[model samples]
Target: MRADAKKNYSHILAVAREVVTEHGADASMRDIARRADVGLATLLRHFPTREALFEALLCTNLDALTQTADELETSNSPDEALVSWFQEWLVFAQSYRGVVAMMAAAHTNPDSALYAACAEVHSASARLLLRAQALGSARADMNGDDLFALMTALGWAVDQPSFAPRADRLFQIVASAILTNPSSKDIKNATR
Candidate 1:
């Protein structure tokens, strides 16, 4: 791609991501083009279909998240690292309210690149969960699958507009439940 073409493509993707995140997956490509200050032809060149654009955006975010998980896995306390990662993860989830639906749809499509990206995130999450278990921070019986389900459910629950105000509290409660050591004093102190 030429320099200007690459720049236009990048801008379209960035704007499309924001629009889709805010207005939902059904957001229009023409609107994205306008937001990006590009033409319809440019948008179509970058993403031929809405599904393609969504998959691209979703994969990009998941890739970044997986990288963050890798970094956290190397932290001194695997338990704290996992918890901290969840805090960040919840924030991301809240920001991209439709992401869970996109991930689910992608996972259901075996041929989609999003499926592969989802698998990578799942693998990275499992590693983080295992490390937390090794550190004696998580319950011995709590497997990676369990943690994954819990996190997904919690993310969806907290993503609701009605639940927005209590999202942080909800996350803290979930984290406290998962963590081996639960202390209200600690949570209070941390909040302060």
Candidate 2:
């Protein structure tokens, strides 16, 4: 990509994140172009379809989240790392309105850009789950696909404005169910 093209791509992504989050996954591409101060053609050139733009933004965010998970896996205790990653995943999933639903849809649509990103995110998540499981902290029977699905559900639950307050408790409940030796603080936090 040329310098100007790269700049446009970056700008479009930034503007798209704001517009999409505020307006929804169905936000108009023309609105994103206007917000970015770029022509519709420029936006279309970078992102031909709504899905393309969404994939770019989602992939960028997930990349950062995955990086954080990798770092946590190395620095934190296995179980703690898993919890931390899940917490972060919850945040990531709940970032934009309807993002969880978008991910869930894309996860199954193998032809979609979101699916590739979801697969990568799932792979990263699996690493954390596997690490905890290896230490006998997480559920022994769990797999990456199941973890991803559970997380998608958690994300969807957390995305609701009313359910926001109970998100931590939800995480704890799920974590406890998965962990052989769940922490007391998390358990207590769930109740509080």
Per-model TM against the reference: 0.81, 0.86
lDDT of 2 at 179: 79
Worst 10 residues of 1 by lDDT: 183-192
> Clash number for every model?
0, 0
User: Against the true structure, whose TM-score is highest?
Assistant: 2
The Cα error of candidate 2 at residue 35, in Å, is 3.0
- lDDT of every predicted structure (CA atoms): 0.74, 0.83
- The sequence of per-residue lDDT tens digits that candidate 2 reaches over residues 67-126 is 998898899888888877787888777677777888888888998768888888888889
Query: Can you give the lDDT of residue 13 in candidate 1?
Result: 79
Give the clashing pairs for model 2: none
